[model samples]
Target: MTALAGDRLPPPLAEGDRLTVDDLALRVRVSGRRKRFALTVETDAGLTLHAPEGRPAAEAEEFVRAHRAWLVAKRGLRERTRPLNPTKRLVEGEVFRYLGRTYRLALVADPPAGGKVNLIAGRLVMDREQAGSPAGGRAALVDWYCRAGRAWAGRRLQPWAARMAVPEPDLEVRDLGRRWGTYRPGDGDSSVGRMSLGWPLFQLPMHLVDYVVAHELAHTRVLGHGADFWRLLRSALPEYEERRSELDELGRRMWMGEMS
Candidate 1:
């Protein structure tokens, strides 16, 4: 006689499940290592609920409800500070930033067959065909920025890597959400280490970009921002503190979509 097959079951939900509390939706993350529940608000990851292992989901929901007021305020603050993903019209006279300089967008009809964006005479000139729509113009602009940012970082990385005594890793320019940059150390077998920098860095001054590069390079030695990390960073940049403060102020404005 033939045996009947058993039905496959779905995997059980773990700590990092999505939970809805009132009008808000939150991510539930359980940490066996933590002693208490915690709430963290980030620009990229909105609301995260960190609960100690074995806590009931119902209790977690109640905790979130209790902190609704705080969550509302934090959400508002993040919305104000986070980068504005504005809808672009891609029209002439629109201003965009490059290497901390303002460049007005201008359309040009040219012999160059394929569409391209060129920085000419302090303006971002694009082929009329490429700048025909908002989406196309945005794509062209972002593509150009990514290429420029990678090259710029490569030049800065050489000196900073030499000073930090770390081998220069690969550079990647992309939208890193809320983070400006991150250093990922390579695992021996499979992973090759690299630095991922936010494309928005091009909007800031060169000094600020250098500071970010230096900060990530320091992570190659020390993983955390401890005293040793600060000491090493200071050895390389004496005015790191001031630069950091300035970046923080400027970064908010840049993220908020203010080009001026």
Candidate 2:
């Protein structure tokens, strides 16, 4: 008899699994480095559970069942706060947001040669040619937002960096998907840091904008959201928690691009 392969090998462990709890489906992932189990609910990704490696699958299912009430409530809240997908056609009377203000689009033929966008008299004025085509209109609008976002960040970063005692990091405004901003630290002591802020931030108020900047700057001192990070952030913005809450509430609406 050949020494059976099954007798010499250990049973396979589940690295990934899925289960349903109270009508909510959860994606379970087992990680070798995870010391404890945790659950995260995201707007786009739904529910996910992380368990310590080699833990019995039955234990993970039981954990979900234990927190069934909390999971159901959180998922319901996420659905209520989901952003609306507004019409994207570039047309006159359409609304766009900037620096927490809504401006209506106004198409004009004053500048016949080239197309441009400008916020004048509470209106986003655009050349007729630019407004006639969706691509042209979106490009002009996005270009304006990018320029304005950079200028706005430049003005705020200097003061905040000085207050936080961190070197001013390079700023880049772009779509950051689900994130408001990200801080990329350089390789070593001699490296310069870079911070990429989402253009959607322009749709929020200045106080909230400052909170995001301060949050990223604080990362320069502490990498994680430990007690030290909160302490440092509080020293700069005492009401940061309030601002953060407001930001979260307004986040979906801002991304919707609808008139307030």
Candidate 3:
């Protein structure tokens, strides 16, 4: 949340902050230590310009112009690899998955107390009134995922924590934007930690869900995705690389509450 370039340059943003070029919609980052300007295309197709502190706006603009050709090609490559999460229609017989099992939407006239989805007889029984509208159906379905995912992850957390030999952190399941899961370390003396998983993760197979949980649990012992972290995770799950690949491939295609 650094500075965005405007007519007049504001004071230098905090070290290593985001500056934006409105024309290209690419971000400009200013760092005090940076001596040379560099261009990078983020995995998510985000363009970034790493420039030294107090660089002129015109100069930055020129740097971007010089690299426009390369930028376009790199961006195209990134766009091809980015996830194309499909939207749901929220109608009768619409397909959904829960832990790798397929269930068709079955709208029922009579809904229970709340508009939560029920897994009854291999069908996702949702309220017809609720599913009549895209907004309501999307909300109801996401709520179901959050509540159900919490319980499932809660039961599965302790076992993974025990296997990893790390203290179990508080777990939450909800929309985490583009990330599958995240973990924040707590003070060692009293706090264990905090872990969050996107509700959409529940749509993946159990093994992949377990992979996300275990991946976060490993952070309890190791911080970054460095060699030490991978080594620690490998000790617990020998086939972690395979699981990671599967999750990456399958997770992107999972339903993310988008409606048609």
Leading candidate by lDDT: 3
Q: Score residue 54 of candidate 1 by CA lDDT.
A: 69
Q: Estimated TM-score per prediction?
A: 0.65, 0.70, 0.71
lDDT of 2 at 56: 62
Q: Candidate 1, TM-score vs. the true structure?
A: 0.65
Model 3 lDDT per residue over 65-90, tens place = 88888988999988867787888997
Off by over 4 Å in 3: 1-80, 113-115
* TM-score of predicted structure 3: 0.71
RMSD of candidate 1 to the truth, in angstroms, is 10.2
Query: Which is the better candidate, 1 or 3, if ranked by lDDT?
Result: 3
Please report how far candidate 2 places residue 114 from its true position, in Å: 8.8
RMSD of each: 10.2, 7.7, 8.6
Q: Show where candidate 1 strays beyond 4 Å.
A: 1-88, 111-115, 189-192, 255-260
Largest TM-score belongs to which candidate?
Answer: 3
For 1-260, candidate 1 gives per-residue lDDT tens digits of 43367854434225879988988888878877988778988886399988887666777778899999999899987876675443345678887777788888888878244437878888888888877665666667777777888989999999998997877777899878758899998888356578999887887889999999999998887888999999989999999999998887777666322222
Decreasing TM-score order of the candidates: 3, 2, 1
